[model samples]
Target: MKIRNLRLLPLLGLTSLISLNAAAVTVEHKPTDQIIIKFDNANVEGNSQARTLSTRLNKKLAFVRKTSQGSYVFRLPSRENFSSVKAYLKVLKAISGIKYAEADQMMFAINDLAVPPTEGIVGTKKPIYDLQWHYFEPVGGMNADGAWNQLDSSDSVVNVAVLDTGITAHPDLDANVIGGTDMITAQSISNDGDGRDADPSDPGDWVSRGECYLGSKASNSSWHGTHVSGTISAFTNNSAGVAGVGYNKINIVPVRILGKCGGYTSDIADAIVWAATGEDNPNKAQVINMSIGGAGSCNATYQQAIDTAVAAGTTIVVAAGNSDDDAGNYTPASCNNVISVASTNRAGGRAYYSNYGDVVDLAAPGGETSTGARNGVLSTLNEGTTVPAAPTYAYYQGTSMAAPHVAAVAGLLYVKKPSVTPTEVKTILTSTARAFPDSCVQCGSGILDAGAAIAALDGSVTPTEPAAPSNFTAIAGAGTVTLNWSDQSTNETGFYIEKRRKFSNQWGTYRSVVRAAADSTSYQDSVFGGTYQYRIRSQNSTGDSAWVVSGEVSVSRN
Candidate 1:
């Protein structure tokens, strides 16, 4: 996933009526020949305004067409200047009777593609569970296993639309995939030789040197959409391959928008709108995942599409980009009404390349593979370089990988509470996320806690005690003992540790008690030399959990 730096094309004009304030973290708009504008009235003389502006600027603003959302598209006269579009946008937004105006910025697939191992059976053996550490590991994983326990076939069916390149049929993933639309309108970007079709198969987006823009390097096809889909709903319990966060119960709608050098904001926005109100698709996507983005302020086109989708009860999840800059500088991620997610690594910290800022809504295991492939997010992929090839699996690291974790969990939430609003879904995700175990500045409320999020949706379930701490160990020193264990619950208010004297044949009554604060994982004791054993349990407002006992340890007096 080499990021393609698109050079600015000639300025164009369009009008829109959706008045959205520009994102707070505004930057120079990305180069585009087209602009979307909204006039105060639906049936305004848009051509008249275009003519007057054209006269003032001495450049023709050729009208393209009106959008379903009432915005108008206009192409500007061809020019090589990068600032020409921004300069024209500044002028167009201020024109009388205009409600909103913005450049039709290009969006990109936010990822750093990792190479796959050369020698290994694809699906013969299960993907090592520990290799997929982002799912179950307490320190860095999303704890999706806990959510899987709570989810079953009885839960409502959730449709998740993955707006990415498209899907490559994989033995492990095709079972859950349904028909999707190809939303890329431009043939050059679509790479499929056609525009807007029902078949959503991915035509490889391999680029030659400098094909996207000056200095852009050549790269292979990422098969990014399949990997993302696998993360969301890859077949599980079939005795092979990796497990999905959705537990193989959710349906994946592959909405192909990104291809070649990535996709246009217009196509992505249209896909969002279609997911919301398209009558052609019966299984309306309850959740939409956009693991793609680009540098820019949130614009009216993105905001309006998100608003429309949110109004239709679809929870939109977007990548916070991978630029290591403010996510507010990216479209859709910075757009209002979408849950923007930042990337965390296997160390439970912000990924080195993850974008972060106030606009981020949550964090998830995006993975870091600089050290090894085992550390990255592994999912279904293809062996192709320029076209479709044999299906395979590979590890990919980026905010693109992180967004699906949240999106999959969102699908789980929707399954549990089918009538839940988009805002409520966002609330449960952010509110229930656990505090980051490592430093991740401005990485949203916290890393996503799947089990906690699923449980939070049910108000009637009785409160339960926190899980008992495990892996308890005691190391004895002269007149002292140090005890340590792992915290196993998210609701513990504190921990209660009790110790007993070890006699020749048995242990004495456990009387001595020590209280450790919430989230505590260790405690040291100063004691007279003696043989002893300790037991501990996590406690909360509900009750104390079952106790876990440690092995006996002997101490010597000084």
Candidate 2:
């Protein structure tokens, strides 16, 4: 996709806001203007200070709604209006306990719109597996082909909620999708003329540079959601345009949040919660793939929703952001409990644009578009910009493409171990990750390896008397604790392990053990409770996973 230089245009006055609508926007103070003030607190103006402030301002305020953050939305009625929105903010800031007051700002998607293939195909009998080198190349490629044979492709229990522009019609994906929902609230912006509804279809987020006061050039509709969905689950083996990380569309659940000018921060926060249905709610997504993000640290609204989803047993895999800056500055990725993924190129080196930092949990093949489509990541796409047109396949770049790879892998993990905890999934992935074949300092612990991850579950390959293991866990005992996932499936007999006391917040050496496991499902190690950690992996005629230790787990005794 080609990114046109974007210009930020702030909607400053009531006239500009009112000029936006085909009809007048019913605002708080001016029943006539469209501006809304995000107040920090509720209006019990009965309080002396509030009453005085309310009286001084002639126009009374009314409560709108409490936003995701504890802040309140209060409309200061237009008194033939006395000042500009800038002046109104100044007055509101003067009041005591007024956390913050400003107009609800607008945001847009930070994606570059590239031209689609001019000569499109209605359908194809063969999937261009070669076109998707990002999935097949060994250097940085995810071992998706091997994982497909092991995972339950059609298991209705697993579904990945794609929170992006929404998925549209494509022959390769139509059969795999169960259903979707539209979460866009701004009716005019949605272009669908509706607020929230059951239709989670992409309406093409193509925009003219002037629409949002963007100084960049106009663009064609980039089928962003469809491309993202294809990476996770485009119908495979149908001889279509491309293969997928998981199975076909059945694995994806489209949850639309982005529209005409990207989407609001508030809309995305709500979709995160909705994807994981609560009590009496039937929507149960095991993995939520937010291949979307923008600048800024996490806000309370995004923080709360992420916490709720994790508590509900959902694993969120997010893009580490395309900014190349520290992942710490991007949202949802920087948010707690998410498996943040950075992008790696064909040679296992970090993609030039992938954001990196302590927040990223792993790395995956997101591809580089500098050399054009053949070198970029290919997935599902559409020929239209504002409406649905012929189905096609195109290449795209960005950490946006990297996220679904990890999300689908998490989905595969769920199919293998339905009883696995979200914490365990993170541990196993970080543990079994294969070291990058090239230099990618701090991209994450390692690149994803599917074959090693499912080895224990399938009872296929076994481990030999070798080095250590990955994703090891312990069961507390009087003097001994047993390590987990050290399975001696079929070929080899046992495993070699290592231990450290996490002294001074640092791990010691593995010189203590020669061999720590055998022909059993787990290995037993003796220890006391100061916080012990271990590392091990299943090995065969082939080699075992990387020696990276799983994150520390606390052990205790009654």
Candidate 3:
């Protein structure tokens, strides 16, 4: 394995900060009235299973199509009533031979405003270095400058797939971009007059007032894919507008999924599979950036797609979301086998609008334009209101901005260690992250330290016995006791949860009750009227840590 050459661009001008109000954009996402079902068997028997489920639920469910991940899409006879459709889903889930059933939820870009660039100095070609504080500031930046100095310069290019509104022709980014495809299946959403074509250029995602939903405000085209691609592979040391974290060694594969009023989960899922397995790709994408998402639990569609991609050795990185809520409430962010990134401000604190929770894998510089435009992440953009226009740069703020930073770093890691698995990449990234300089509760291990992550590829960062779980607690319920703890180790494969009943041995001898997956912070155990104490420890192939015990809690009712 070889490391790519990283050249740090010289800082030219004074830091120019612009204080601009972040746009108030309401990008609501909801189910598309279609249900996705996966049967135990997906052959002819699958159709039979669907028919049997329709008969059981007493609703006319029409087969729509098959998703790339092998899930079957079905449409109810009437879209007028969604309550009945949801009710049918409940019945469908209970039917045997059905693997899973869920509504095809919609997802949108997780970014806010896209304000045009502000003037830096009177006249100079280095406005970008002064404006892009999120990349080099010692307090809040990801320290890309330090990471660049550590690269070996003898490695091959790394491919990163950007799944978003698609890419536009930007002089700053086109050189590093490669062949890509549009994966949007809906004609209305594609907005380009066709569906699933070879062209991956963004056709603009602008929508009129109430176009997305009732009373929804009109929105301009975000050129989101362009911005994200710029963050990953913009030409470095070219005296260009802004510097990319990948140092121009990343080849972006744009897989367009989001369109007009956001995109469908089914489409995004298919895009993930395609981006991971497409044979036409010059090189397999080692890292995928999903800056687009919505409010929802991790459904089967996304889980299967993500699992498939990870199994194919692609490290997926997703935004934790911008709703300022727990990231566990979002889809791919909550989904297993991906790096979920939370947003941070220029002050190195949690951004005002970033999602936070145990699900988040780490934090990155997403930027907060509310403080100042210069504080926001600067990236390539198009100045068109509804279509492609003159190429430009802008300041944008959101988890959408943060994900590409991590993805770019992941690309660099892959360049250094070509054979590393997706899990290894995630572990290195989380373990190498530096502790947050400011308060950022539940923001995962720490803020992304690109220099540390890159340097970790030298085998200096070795895995050891994981630290003991912290904040262990037990709460008594009607007939069950819920055990909760915080994961403190980045390399742990899972958790060993042990519990002892008060009546059995005075809480003296504990037995392993459950072995939860890595990053699992909570578990529930049913009991028949007895007090119990719990303890948890992080486990890996290397070893396990000492147990962190919890107080006794009694479940009085059964």
User: Can you write out model 1's per-residue Cα lDDT over 1-558, one digit (the tens) per residue?
Assistant: 010111111111111101100011123344566677888899766677678768765778877566657887776764223477778878777778889877777676633344345322223322233346687655687866557656656777789999988999888789999878898886777898998899899988888886765555687777889889989998775555666788767999999987886776777788888887766776689999988877777787888888998998899999897778899878778888999999998889998888899999999998877756567787777767789977766677788889999999999988888888999999999998988989999999999988778778865352476798989998899988899999888766556677899777678887434445565688777678889999887755334588889898889985
Candidate achieving higher lDDT, 2 or 3: 3
On a 0 to 100 scale, what is the lDDT of residue 451 in model 3? 70
Candidates in order, TM-scores: namely 0.76, 0.67, 0.75
lDDT of 2 by residue, 423-442 (tens): 87788777777899987777
The best candidate in terms of TM-score: 1
lDDT (CA) for every model shown? Answer: 0.75, 0.63, 0.76
Compare the candidates by lDDT and give the number of the best one.
3
| Residue 29 accuracy (lDDT) in model 2 | 21
Distance from true position, residue 531, model 2, in Å?
60
Instruction: List runs of model 3 lying over 4 Å from the truth.
Output: 1-29, 45-62, 76-85, 95-97, 110-126, 279-282, 460-558
**Count of backbone clashes for each model?**
9, 16, 2
Error of 1 at 331 (Å): 1.8
Task: Give candidate 3's root-mean-square deviation (CA, Å).
Answer: 18.2
